[model samples]
Target: MKKETRHRATIIDVAKRAGVSKSTVARVLGGSPNISEEAAERVHAAVSATGYEPNHLAVGMRSGRSGLLGLVIPDIANPFWADVARGAQDQAAKEGMSLLVFSSDWDSAKEAAHLRALRQARVDGAIINPVADNLDGLDRFGMPFVLIGSSAESFPDTSSVGSDIAQGVRLGMDVLLAHGHAQPAFILGPKSKLARARFLRAINQHCIERDIDPASLHTEDSDYTVEGGKEAMSRLLERASKGRHLAVFCANDLMALGAILAVRDAGLRCPEDVSILGFDGIPSGAFSWPALTTIEKDGRKIGSTTVTCLFDEMAGRPEHGRVYIPCRLIERGSLANLLAGNTDRLAAGR
Candidate 1:
């Protein structure tokens, strides 16, 4: 015996069962305020009786809105990005929309491909943390997009949400200088990113203002991972001068944690022998062996704000331009007062 295939119920079936026009059913499903209560009740009753489900794709085709948002980031493994994704997801849920997140792993080609996929998926908008400053194909994709943690120079008209990198750097430098360190070494990220460039500029400006020779400041680039931080910190230790206390500032918390380990491997204690600071304010920093002092960028707030900007753009609201979130200094045990004279001599140099 052959089994009969059941046909799926559509909005038309519900409308026919309810003895109402298709337009009335559409308005009821779309939650139009203009729909009368009697019509809405009939549509709901018919929908239940017919077991009809709205096809989101068909609705989107007619309405030009998919009720979906795409979020693209470099690395999802990083705790900072994880927090960012969570925040964005929460906000999207509150707005009656769904979020689709993608990790590009810092690959420019992959990032572009993800953008294309988002367009094909008909996402209402997108928020991207680009792999690099180049966004040549973004405008041609014909979707409204917001940049997160990126520079305004490349896409000046695009909306963005990020912390003030210069202010954060200045705050960290002030803390180091207050502790009697004339010049602090830097564990910076790759120069291709705007964050690193802004940080480098801020550190140089800070040194110059304090009458410290900017050239005297030791700097090393890393891949923004704990291992990369460890390697960079180890190299800095090998070349450091003798009889001087060393203060270091890392681009992010993961790097700072690795730097602390490097200090220990070199037979030096954090704060007592070497002072370190980091950025991003990741939660793990608070629970590390020696709590990390960092420039708090508030990834959650940045994510939520980016979503808000994208929603506003989708609603045809006036563009507010770039939004700069302020960064704060979170002082913790990782940084020590060199002025207290508890510094110990290092085996390598100082």
Candidate 2:
């Protein structure tokens, strides 16, 4: 094969184009606040002209702060995590930083591997939603890391940001109760984070207080996907019997959409035959048929807050403890009176 030549530009090119010393280019890339405004503008113009993307690896080797953050999660496909990723991305970009992402798929071994990889990448910090509660391996790494949405049996000095799902679930339950739903079926995702479990327990407790027998409450588990929600709701309906007045609360909006599909396929009407409630008010939920009634969490706020905490650590501040992100409920048309006409008619002909 013939040799192929590729055009590559370096910091020297940027400095030459900007008519500045190489040190000045380096300082600009390092985000030195002391750089003069006019000088900064010239360096930015030169950088754009030369299309010189810095050698981040070499920079990381030279300085402990790589201006890079690593975010590890289970699934990017999940809207909840997608929102989390958005938050991290927004925060990173705002701080003139970049991010490296890894999905552990709920596997400890994979999580361990990513942790080691991030260390080698010399990231400035990491925000991880651990696959499970195995913090021993992470604790031993002794790096600047924060946890998001999960915790361990014995955490050793880590910062965390997680949704208050317990409060969220309680709020959903209270909303359903206010809307005259006495018996609502529950759909839970398979992930067993402390927050999720707490929400589950709170909702179950709420049922008890409402005189619902444990056996009478329909419940099922899924893999936290839209398809999983659909199948689980199908199973719930099969076991609970048809024509029974019911409401459904899903662990997430994706699941709620799935359940809504299942309910409609069964020729039952949402909010009419069964009111549907979901957690994590993803944008898609709003445009969903009849509009989904769900809880909304400020994902961008969480992301920005997590980055702020990470910066504190980078600045040599003490490691942080847990941080809680509040949740809110949004009532829409997905929830309706039990006696209302078949929502199938409203949902149909779409």
Candidate 3:
């Protein structure tokens, strides 16, 4: 067989076509600021014409900037976290940077290990959603980094991009209260400080705004899992004696779906026996039996924006700031207006 010939373009070809020195081409490729505007235009024109892509590894080695961002997430399997990762990944790629991810699995040891690895790799920056309560350990890390999703209020040294969960909770509660739910039940996540703090702040704020007693709102904390939601809901159903129609707001969608099942298991119907609202608009939540009413946290936006923030930080720009992505409420059939009859059924399972 004849030797296979590749048609890939090289930097020399671009340099020749642009009538610029190879050094100029290298500077342009490395995003060096010393290059002139006219030279950059010519190099860009040549690049577009030849479809030439620079070798990232070679460029990184020369510049001493790996152009690599290390992203550490608490739990990759959770749809909420998945959204965040996706956003960060897309943004990093858009900036011509690579993302190196490490799943902490909600384990502190694993998180610490990942941080050490990132530092060992000498990454340009990190975007970490810390697994531990305080990421004080990361302070010793010399690389630039941003915190995504979760924030430790006590530790304000790092930059972050996160959701306004308190706002999400407030919105969910407002919708429920407006629908005539006098007493609402909360399905919370694990004992993370941020989770607990968000719930407490939102509940207090909502109660004050609605002129309702804070003690009237019922709360149950569990792991950020479907089973946790189920167990927590079961306990709430037991306490929901005297035919009181409960409006339940879950911390996350998985828990909300679990609560929906628990409500059904308790010989009650959703939006009929109770109104259910969930957080994190995971796609599965929309396809659940009754279609879950949830707060849509734009994971795509969060992920992409976090990457942008990380890149900005890496550039030594004035970007040490916190970004809060607003939550949107998706109205589904799960929330029922106060009526004496039990009605509504889940859609066919996907």
Candidate 4:
């Protein structure tokens, strides 16, 4: 049997059925409030009869807005980025906008390509976690954009949102000191990373305040991954001073998890033989054998705040400064209190 073919409906068919001009149909569908109730009712009924579907591209061309926004991040697979994207999506819905997401995988070329694609799509604006050292991507973009991530602090001239890195470092150091850890081990990212510098500076200041020599600080560089943390911690463990408490701080949670594994592999117990502190309190941290002690930076709040900044830029407001979300300490089982009288206080923090 030959199936019957159905012709798709267009605005012209809707106009003809409603006895109105095509422009009237267009205006009604575009949500212009100037149409008469009688005409609107007839157009809506005609739309129902014809099953006409508006082409969003054409409507965007006519309305000067696509009703869309764009988001570009370094990595989508990271739990932190996942949370950030979810926050952006939720806020977009609240603002009556749709979002398109892309990941650059930390490649400058890929980041540039995503920016070009966003331009071609004619998004109202964008929120980007920039990868390149310069503002070339933002320079080429014709619309408003807000920067995000650890590196955003380097570009103070542009509007950016991110977790408070220095503050987080201070909080971590305080926890380490509270637990009688003065000679600490730091698992840091690449030296070029701004976050690493911030961490070192805060640690240095903390040591100076305590009258400890900054030159005595021990650190191992890592790639901000699980394996990287394991390898770095292993090296630090082998070279660490003997007969003293070991306190290790990882640049992020993934690395810290690896550090825990390294300690276990070396026949050392967490919080008993080695205490670990991690940053970016991802969900997996809670499930770790020794629920990770971490500085919980709110990725969701960072994402939503970045959108708010982009909106300000889209609204013709000057967004030239950085907006930072504070970090909170999550004192979990991984860190042990050493002060004889401080057990109750530290337990309450958990």
Candidate 5:
């Protein structure tokens, strides 16, 4: 037998149930303060009774706003970006707006496509970590937007938000210094990238302040990944003087985890043989072999604040400017068995 179709409740049904004009029901549902409280109450009751739901498309047409926000990020799987997306989503909900999120996977073409799609959808605003330097597409669309991530710093005139990378590095280094690990090593990004430049500048300043030789610092270039970090760490360990409290700072938690693995792979104990410090306070790091000490960048704050900036742009209020949120250092077992006591896996695995 053919199933009978169910009719969806409409604004008219709500108006009829409330015993008010359709315009009055519309005004009440649209949150117009001009509507009488009595009328609004009746309309709300009628809406519940009739199971009335407004057509979002129709509402957008009437208000000249889609009531939607767009986000385009480098990697959805990365825990940092995930937190960012969550923050933006939460903020959007508070303002009665919907969020549309996309991951560009570090592809410029894909990034461009997502931006175009946002324009086509007529999103009220967007937050993007741009993959391409050229942003002619944004100019053409005229949709209000905010840039996010360390790369956002490159666009000085754009409204943007990101972690204070240089400050975070310095904070991590200071901890190393206080702990008497004067000549700390590093697993950094490739020099061709902006991230590497920021890291180098911070490292140089820290060295200069303490009268430490910049040339004496041992550093290796690696992509921001566990495997890359492992390889870089392995090379650093191989060439270094044999075993005397070697400390290495990783660009991110994933790389730090990799470094830990490399030490273990070489039959060396973490913290005892080498101390590790990381950036980007991913939640998973807390549960690592030894909890990873890190410079914690507030990704959620970056995301939510970016949304706030987008709103300002949407309203044509604040002029464009970059916002840098400060990062804090979290010390744990990886900094040499000080905080989190660890059951040495490298020894046990043997």
Candidate 6:
């Protein structure tokens, strides 16, 4: 049997078929301003006829641009991160660039490896949601990068876009306190992370300003998962006494949902027994039994803004030091006013 040989089309073939010079074909394909309308039309027609595919790798090599961007996130399972990925992807497409996402699973070692891989792939730039507080070697990568949802202290010089975590936490606390919950507990993420540390610090500051004993505040660390939230809530319940209007402010909606579940599992009611407040306003929070009242942070906007900053840096634009997206309080069913003696306001509308 004879082996079949495949034929590949080239720019030379396109130029020959278009009855134009190779330089004219190159200009038309490269979107050069020197090309005439007629020449462009002829080049496109020849490309269709000859099925010529431009060698992007060769072009990128000569131009020193990969036209690719990287997004490093800690978790892909979380809906917040998923929304962020979508927003970044949308923005990337608008700029005629491609995005590659890497999930480090909140591991510092994996995060570092992913950064190394992105640099090796020669991506034009990157937006990273760092997993650790110390980003010591990030500058050595020599690629322009923007931090998203990471603490300001992590990468002081890099442009960053994130929700105002401290403000969000304070909002949640104020709401609970206004509703007459005096001793609100906190379900925190790992304190080692900057985001969590900021949250804890904000809670402490709020307590100090209110003349509440800082040592009286209860805090439990969790992994930011539903199960982790449930476990943290359960631990709090063990120390909680009955007849007290207890409230818990969770770091994120997932944990808040878990806390609600734990409350129910303990043969108690949400908002009636223990009010729950969450951050990150994820869609799932709305569908929960007692819809979560949360601090709404637009993850999509954060992602888009981070990418915009990264592209700006890539284009030699002046760095925007730190961009903080504001958070809004979305009142829902999960949080209730204990002093009002009516749970009507805690309806599932946000």
Write one digit per residue (lDDT tens) for candidate 4, span 53-166.
Answer: 888787789878888899999888778888899888888888978899999998889988998999999999999887754554457777888888877777788899998888
Worst 10 residues of 5 by lDDT: 338-347
Per-model TM-score on C-alpha atoms:
0.86, 0.84, 0.81, 0.87, 0.90, 0.89
**Runs off by more than 4 Å, candidate 6:** 1-22, 45-53, 343-350
lDDT tens readout by residue for model 5, 234-294: 9999987863568999988889999999999998877777899999999989999889999
Candidate no. 3 TM-score = 0.81
Q: Give the TM-score of candidate 2.
A: 0.84
lDDT of 4: 0.87
Flag regions of model 1 displaced more than 4 Å.
Answer: 1-26, 32-53, 342-350
- Model 4: residues >4 Å from true position, as ranges? 1-22, 36-53, 135-138, 340-350
- For residues 1-350, what per-residue lDDT tens digits would candidate 6 score against the true structure? 99998789999999999999998998888889987888899999999998898876778898999889999998999999999999999999999888999999988889889988998889999988888677676677679988887555577677898898878878888898899877889899986777788888888898889999978889899988999999999999999976565789999989999999999999888887789999999999999988899999999998888888898999899989889998999998988787786654443221
Report lDDT (CA) for all predictions. 0.87, 0.80, 0.82, 0.87, 0.87, 0.87
Ranking by TM-score: 5, 6, 4, 1, 2, 3
Clashing pairs in 6: none
Model 2 misplaced regions, further than 4 Å: 1-6, 14-48, 152-157, 191-196, 208-215, 339-350
List clash counts for every candidate, in order. Answer: 0, 0, 6, 0, 0, 0
> Model 1: what TM-score?
0.86
lDDT of 4 at 202: 83
Candidate 5, residue 241: CA error in Å?
2.3
Residues 57-152 of candidate 1 have per-residue lDDT tens digits of 887898899889999998899999998899899999999889999999988789889988999999999998877787676677578888887555
